[model samples]
Target: MRTAKFWMGTLLAGALALGYGCGSDANKDPTPQDVPQQQVPDAGADAGVVLTLTDAQIARVLQVANEGEVMLGQYAAPLATDQAVIDFNNQMVTEHTAVKQRLDALLAAEGITPEDSPLSLQLQAEVQQLMDVLQGPNAPAAGAALDLALLSAQLNAHARTAFIGDSLLTPQATNTALQQELASERQAVQTHINEASDLQSVIVLPPVEP
Candidate 1:
């Protein structure tokens, strides 16, 4: 549980740092930029749907990520037995809920309604798959198996999120505010990865029965 405490504290510190001196000169309405026609993950399934996303589309995808984390955290809470894992789940729920609220406020202030894209839809599907794995009839029991599963899922999810933030969202951001926000988000996701990795180190899963 100490690691859980440290993870929450780190996230809080990062959020405060972001809020302290980063908002004075940001553009309220960031202009949308044209990204080159590139293939996103699962692009082949969509065929001709180029992932040249607008700021609104990026926001929508970000919202999906945030919401997915919140859902995963909530679902894991009752099923997790390890104190550290439980703490992690609670903190994720808290931070992601707060982050989503802030994002919603930002979008409202800018009079921007996030627009969905093929990327966002694909992400939604991926998140749902994770949820199914946890919630389905064959879900792992509430112990080391569950803990390992949750940690592994978070590791993969956050890594992908950080990659998207760095490779796609930040570069496509035309608004200084959105860029700054995305930078902060990327940092937070990295922190999550670190914490998840640490938790994974301490968990010992049972050997599979052949």
Candidate 2:
């Protein structure tokens, strides 16, 4: 449950920050952008992969990506003591949540209920295992490490997701919210990766100039 708090707290803090920072727009379009049109996936990748995803497929993808991104943001939020890292984490959470909202609107237009991804469901299971570990003696450092890794993966995962969403949903005419969200996410992840890289350095002394 404490682990759960880690995830939820990140989301809550991020939303609060977003709401206070710029104020989310429920009605405004994400903004106009030049996203490439959707393309069909590789035919050789999988036998059962559908070429043209239904509206349902789109919705499911959005739902999982949003929730996962939030969880990822939450996981990353407290991992860094640096201000940049914290800001980046907050940016990721805010953007993804906005994406989730946009996707939700699209889904409701079709009267759909989004389902969690099998991949995310598996992650949740792993989270459960992590929670078990956190409850025991491995709670402190192990838990902290777990959040770091998860958020790192989230940044990468979100990149792929952005590509996939652009391809599948064809967000050519995004509103101000979606556009800003995309920009924020792209920037946040890049910043987060840099910060994480700095933190992970071995701290070797500089080589003497020959």
Candidate 3:
């Protein structure tokens, strides 16, 4: 009975973790026949979306999001026409660069880069796996869709600023800075999703290039 109870508990923990990882709303990306997303227009121009990513958090955010964008573009090349790919490519570049710019401004104001170590490497490895699948033969459509959804949730949960910016407005020694930083990151994640959705629209041209 003890052994059985242990297994049951472990199973329950795993299930909860999986649910959280996939997102509370499994239906968030509903598309026809499980394709995950409806046809989105080719993202027209860089001006189409504006996200506020500060320079303080730019490097890490870039490291993660860029890898994700690259994986998405390469792995799912067949999903969108060439023009749509180009549009997505442009959007990714624009929004990510904007993140860099904002971070740069913040850095000049406050002289620090947040601590990042093995975490960045871990994320890079995951991106490379997705890339390999894309660049590899026999890559299935199902795998690509699953990877995109997983990465979307991961990025959404990550921090936006190197340090919370709210404390900065207070005194230099106050603890509230961390909270402000977290809030800023949360906001940045929302902006990223909106821009990504916008870019998804324009990729529906006939015979989307792989």
Taking all chains together, the TM-score of candidate 3 against the true structure is 0.43
- Which ranges of candidate 1 are over 4 A from the true structure? 1-50, 205-210
lDDT by residue (tens digit), candidate 1, 36-149: 011223323344332466788889989998998888889777778888998998899999899889988888887678988756776677677777666666656566767877
Per-residue accuracy of model 2 over 59-118 as CA lDDT, tens digit each: 565566567667656765776454545665677688768767775775566566555443
Model 3, global lDDT: 0.38
Candidate 3: where are CA atoms >4 Å away? 1-79, 82-86, 140-182, 194-210
Per-residue CA lDDT of candidate 3, range 140-161, in tens? Answer: 3544343343333223222111
User: Which candidate number maximizes TM-score?
Assistant: 1
Residue 149 lDDT, candidate 2, scale 0-100: 38
lDDT (C-alpha) at residue 25 in model 3 = 39
Q: Give the RMSD in angstroms, all C-alphas superposed, for model 3.
A: 13.8
Best by lDDT: 1
Per-model TM-score on C-alpha atoms = 0.73, 0.44, 0.43
Write down the lDDT that model 2 would get: 0.43
Alpha carbon lDDT of residue 95, candidate 2?
74
